[model samples]
Target: MTDTGPRVRRIDAPRQDRQDTETYPTVARAVTAARRLVHRHPDRCRLREVGRSRAGRPLFLLSVDDGERTVLAVGGPHPNEPVGLAAAVGLAERVLELPPRPGVGWHVLLCLDPDGAALNEGWLHGPLTPARHYEHFFRPAFHEQPELLPAPDGPLAPMPESRVLTGLIDELRPVLQCSLHGVDFGGAFVQLTRPLPGLAAGFARSVARGGIPLDVDSYDAVGWDSPAPGTYVMPAPGTRWRALPDRPELSTWSYAGRYGGVTAVLEVPMWAIDAVGDARPHPDVRAAVGAAARTLHERIAELTGLLPQVPPHAGVAYGPLLRAIEFNLEVSPLLVEEWLADWSPAPLSVSRVTTARIVAQRLPLRIASMLLRLLADSGGPAADAARARARGIIAASLEGLHRLGIRWVPIGTQVGHQTRAALAAADLLLARR
Candidate 1:
């Protein structure tokens, strides 16, 4: 499965020169910048409200092209993954600057989950570190995630934000949809709704051009078909939907795929780990994965044990954090157990070992962070004691991660890689047609 299509040349997006290179912009800041960009180019760009979030924040759509064929770009599907927001903005700017194509229009959804994104803004003003990120971390639970909600037309009603996306899909029926996404820590990768011959090569090249390591084996890349390293073929709706927690519900990419559009999920990372791309065989695959599973289970037990001692009610402000802890508690251990069960004596790559360790160690920090946030928010003598204990756990986890040798990737670097990958994807779509 080589790239049978034309060779993909490296694409480099213009570097951004913001005051704080390491920090990402808040929802308000990102939206404001997007509006200003649209406002600056009256003829080429048009900004309009598409829908409202659950919390009543307006979801705006920025249309940069009026061509017959359309390319749909969505950002911030997961609020915690804000790299895409900056990428979306950059994409819109690039589209505006380019000479008009014959019939390829571009529509950019700057931020899909504005309410959820707002919750994560605390870390936006950061000397961004692993410790700081988890401390201010927030992610809606499975049921609350817009992209993970049941189908818009299903018996289970979709979230207000998801409905907006469904409606947009119906209206645009785009030729290509780029769902911009990012991870807390990993090398860069892309997930495609289906095979688009040369797209993966372009995406890989884009990652290289941005000086980012290619994540050859991501945690989610396990079950997918890969024509190239760092690129995965996401199973269509009915194929592997059951593998995920929310069965039968289509993600944004799958939803777009239903309309005969190809989706390229540009997944970058905030923290960089070059080891994730190493193809060298791990010395002991079974032992590495087994150890990772043990580490995860141990942490899960310790964290879940603390819950009984603390108050159940942490208020609305900490709901996301609470949900994160609850969801991870139920799911993380099971995932690790399943992985261990499924393991065999195969040629496991170093990247696989790195991914395993990341899943085991870093994931628990998120859970610990959520617990700490919940405890801190409760504000009582007992809660204070619990918070202190959680902080100790977090400190140990952070120290463990430091030993893993992960590096912090600048926000601009992440956005640049995503923007380039997206542009490359768009090119592949046009080339396919």
Candidate 2:
């Protein structure tokens, strides 16, 4: 379907009447259309207020069901990642028109962090500006902005929206969870659980079929060397930490790990989604993407049966690993800048240097840490095997850095800092012992 021009149709009108309108626009427009959709299709869809965002926006959950399996998809965990919200709203509209598979259920949580999203609206519609400016303003980068927004009482905090999400997860216990996100100009790929063997390939096919080119070469866009495709770098220290105890963060993959279900994160590049700029999807690509979505949905449903329950060790080793990542990030600016200037013949993009520091230095340390835990947990030959695996992962990662042509000074002293932090975190993790 291609767009001829902008046209308005009544919400209660037939799907054909609404064909000209884009599903995703500004938040207000999306919410208004969605509310109208629920009202029009009362039999198939129900809208519920899950919680209030920090700014007091009503976070709505649109539940579409055929009565058996439940799938929950969420968007807008980070203020800048708004495409997911658009996609979620679009998917909701599609679900209403099509007949659901017998026993299938879908719940879409639209714009989980409206407060963060509201802060991002200024840049959403217009001449595309530089990403750095948006980063500075939205504070999507962890260290760039205050961890929590200020409130009249105190720090406004992550808000009850996340808490309510956790509660909903506990109650509904969705079999499959997909969080939608968009990469900046570079880095593009759909991410699912790390350990799943063929999931990436399957997802890539779906994306290609959708007419969006797979960004196989753009790994460095998000951090990490070009050699290692799937890895993303950790943000610098004083930036946001990825994992924290007793807090509900938007890193819902960890949440899925905790809940023991299959979780997938679809990272689409904004360019791909806006390929035609307010135009309709290309007919062939739209057919492919729609098919891919359906196929993926079915595959995820099937995988749910095979998914293992959350293991005690699932996130148990993350504390020390997190500390290691943090330590690397803390020392990265000096080491990475020097390495990029001397070793790399080309002047590196500032973002690339920042990203590489996290990927090359910090990530290896984090992996080494998990190995330490594995050694402690396993016995006899299992310990030996764990050590070998850890060493191999670390070696491969280091080799990846060398391949990327990054040379660093003897910052071995940083390792000691990492060690101390890891030890402290490990102690805390063990204290609960």
lDDT of each: 0.77, 0.45
Winner by TM-score: 1
Per-residue alpha-carbon lDDT of candidate 1 for residues 1-433, written as tens digits (9 for 90 to 100):
1333453334553455222455576777777887797789877788889999988999989898688678999988888898878888878877776787767789999899998887778877776777777878788777888876675576777889989987998899988888888987778988887887766666776677666789897777776688889988875446542223753226766777677888887888887878898988899888888888888888888888878644566745566667777888888877676658774255688987888788888777888887777776566676677777788778877887777777877777777777777777777666565
TM-score between model 2 and native: 0.51
**Which residue pairs collide in model 1, if any?**
none
TM-scores of all models? Answer: 0.91, 0.51
Off by over 4 Å in 1: 1-20, 151-155, 236-249, 309-312, 315-317, 344-346, 379-381
The residue-level lDDT of candidate 2 at 371 comes to: 33
